[model samples]
Target: MAVKVSSQKDTYKATAVFLVLMGVLYLLDKWIDFSDYNLDWVMQKDTMLLYAAVTFLWFKSDKSVGLILAGIWLIQNIALVTALLGQVSTYLLPLTLLLIGVLLYWLSSK
Candidate 1:
């Protein structure tokens, strides 16, 4: 099915929300000295979260192209999440993204 104009509007709104959320997180982390984590690591995590949210929102909107990108981002970050979390998270990386997708899909419905 073709994506409706309303879906496009939803996409834009989702993008705006995601960006604002990331900006706030970044500032809060710096302001609170949340962690002495590596900048690259944090950036990667943020990117993953951003795309996952966007992807789920876009999917229901019939935005196939965006879904491809979101899936790619999640795929690229899978190793990172696993390596950082280690054996304790043998399944966490995939599950995390899946959970994100499910949550975002549900949230977008409203």
Candidate 2:
């Protein structure tokens, strides 16, 4: 099926928002002292991409595309995400799979 023009526009808007947010975040990291907060992981590229993926999923009309991309990003960066979760890392995979399944079922129903 062909994508609607409005869907494409939404995707573009999502991308622009992601880029601008990332830029602001990077600058903030550089200029601010966040060491006490231990939020360095939030500035990582993988984390940013995950955020972008979620943003795309939220904004895109064709959710399957965003879902696929988000899944790929999650799979590829599982280690980073898991590490960020520390003691909760062991539950990450199962939770992620469950969430994906739910999202897929929901999207298919729509």
Candidate 3:
């Protein structure tokens, strides 16, 4: 009973911190110029929301949810993420798939 109450309180605290961080990031994005740095994508609304969601989930003990969300975000923004990798981006999908397969096999063995 006490553990559940503490967990709920921690979750509320995490939620408040997440909201504050998101608000600060949103304000910074609007007030600053990131175009020259080629980092405007980092300040985009969707990106910020995804980051906040991942952080919130991880802090709330929902690590798998955070990982899955982060993975989805990476897939959705792979082009942006690998923009500097050039040709390397082309092999990312297969490499990622292979890694996932290896992870599954290792987990199953465990």
Candidate 4:
């Protein structure tokens, strides 16, 4: 027997997997000093929550929304990288993720 696949199902799976990976990375960053020894525990928790929400929304929703969320995650990761590289120590990742979530929601609605 062959397994049938749906785009929505696939998207949901991808989003779920990505969220898990991100969460792991966040955890690693906590003790591993990946972010310039600057670990914002609260922000990490919030990002995890956002990823959870996106994973939940991946089902039966517009693909663009997920893409946007991913895009935002990409940006946050970049910012975290920047911070870790000793660039700056500002609270920017959470705001960027929030904007990404809202923008993705808007896009999905359109």
Between candidates 1 and 2, the one scoring higher on TM-score is 2
Query: Which stretches in model 4 have alpha-carbon errors above 4 Å?
Result: 1-5, 34-36, 39-62, 67-110
* TM values, all candidates: 0.47, 0.63, 0.60, 0.32
Better of 3 and 4 by TM-score: 3
**TM-score, cand. 3:** 0.60
Root-mean-square deviation of candidate 1: 8.9
User: Tens-digit lDDT track for model 2 on 52-110?
Assistant: 88888888777766677777787888777788889877887688779979998999999
Most lDDT-accurate candidate: 2
The local distance difference test score of model 3 is 0.74
Superior by lDDT: candidate 1 or candidate 2: 2
Question: In candidate 2, which residue pairs get closer than 3 Å at backbone N, Cα or C atoms, i.e. clash?
Answer: none
Q: Is candidate 2 or candidate 3 better by TM-score?
A: 2
Model 4 residue 14 lDDT score: 62
**What is candidate 2's TM-score against the reference?**
0.63
**Residue-level error in angstroms, candidate 3, position 90:** 3.7
RMSD to the hidden true structure, all candidates: 8.9, 5.2, 3.9, 9.2
Tally clashes: model 2: 0
For model 2, the stretches where C-alpha displacement exceeds 4 angstroms are 1-3, 33-36, 77-110
The per-model lDDT (C-alpha) reads 0.67, 0.79, 0.74, 0.62
Best-fitting candidate, scored by TM-score: 2
